[model samples]
Target: MMRRSLTATPGPARLRISLAAQQNGCASGATEVTSARAAIATAQAGLTAAAAADTAARTRYLAATQAVAGARKTMLRVQRQRPYRSARVAHAKSAVAIVTKTMITRRAQSGKATAALTAARTGLSIATTRLAGATSRWKTTCAAVKVTQQKLTGTAPTAELTARAAAISRDVVTQVRATFTTADATTVYGITVHRSVAFAFQRMIDDAKADGIVLSGGGFRTRQRQIELRKINGCPDISTAPASSCRVPTAIPGRSLHEIGLAVDITSGGKTLTAKSAGFAWLKAHADEYGFANLPSEPWHWSITGS
Candidate 1:
């Protein structure tokens, strides 16, 4: 046998069978590789989607943290302002109280000072009134004495006139002494006086008695009798010792005229006499010649010569 033909030629049917088997195997392998590639792509797409979701969540957390921090800062600022506002209110209240207290104290002091000033003014007014009245009487008696003295200038004292004057003094004293018998008159009236003033009172009483002018009630038989005499003689209104003494207490012991002499408070022709007197007015015109003068209040009071 020829060396056997190792390369055998396939008939047409066997070749067809070989080609069919080869095509079937190739199609199966292609299908498996495509399925694996598709699976890989799907896994990659899933990983990308999960990463994107994680990034979005992180961004939102950062924004929320910033908002919280902003809110905390605003709260701290409000807290800081609270104490300052309270302090301001307290200071305002204290200032108002201090001003109110000061105003009240000043008002009280002003009221007290005003009251004291008013009282001082009242005392001064009373003292002024007393001094003015005393000065008015003194001028009147002096005028009457001057006129009386002029009338007597050319004529000397007649024995009858001297007798009459002496009797007048005696009569006046007799009447006045009876009224003065009470304890108060003796204590206040005769406690202090000049010796000459006492002599004048005695002489006047003696003179009035001699003239038959009896002074039953302290140099007045009646007020009406004295008034008639005053009208006839053109005599002025007369006040007596209680109204006419010097208000000031005597500086010298027993020096006041009112204390010893009967105070003859008289005016001339219904008016006070001047220091210069008209003629024939014994209490005014001849008072000095007979040792008499105008007492401070009682214008008609006289003293003895050289008293």
Candidate 2:
């Protein structure tokens, strides 16, 4: 009689536990997605700020260059006037000497010659001072131009920082793509990508289609499939051959982003994708907004991360 209970308590408990686990998984996915979005936003903001700073520095540098040019012109003009002023000073001093030596009837004439010599010397001194000021201004402006150019291009430390930021952005995108699950796989434009990326790909495809482009591709290969392709493509054994010798630049099994369901090899109406194609051009112009980037070596290859 004790074993006659019809209710299954453990079954309901197990069902509840499973449901909770599923909910937690969904929550974790959402959190990851949100984090990825935040990272993208931060990267975009940094790029914008860098661009603005570069523009400002360029403007300042151009102004400094013009200032230097003006200073040089002023210095040249002063230099030209300096020789004339010196000649006038010499001539005036000779006049004074001549007046003093020849006992001139008018002492007023001697006095006038002496005053003219003093004025000429003063004018030469003023011209020399102006030239020196212009030279100093030109040097200062040249220094300013160097500093601004360094800021615009970046010094060693600034260059390293910029490189690190770029690496971080690429890493974040890679991490997001790596988190994709089997359930996240979806068909897009005759290809497959993670559900998270599928919408973006679809948008890109639709937009391209509107512009008279028809795109197609396959994506999301398994490790075994990748291995098979590698063998068929006459890929050199990665363990023995240098990676550079591979005919197809396919990654080793289990090592490809394509295996993670975030990459695709796209084509336009069965034609090979190339830099010249409209579809490729469209993707180049707009794919980054959708969190996709083209693999530089392979025009047909596009992924969440450039790697």
Clashing residue pairs, backbone N/CA/C < 3 A, model 2: none
Candidate 2 per-residue lDDT over residues 12-31, each given as its tens digit: 34443443344344444545
Supply the TM-score for candidate 2.
0.43
Q: Each prediction's Cα RMSD?
A: 66.8, 26.4
- The lDDT per prediction is 0.39, 0.60
The local lDDT score (0 to 100) that residue 296 gets in candidate 1 is 43
- Give the distance in Å from residue 24's predicted Cα in candidate 1 to where it truly belongs: 99
Deviation (Å) of 229 in candidate 2 = 1.3
Model 1: residues with Cα > 4 Å off, grouped in runs: 1-92, 108-158, 168-307
Off by over 4 Å in 2: 1-180, 238-243
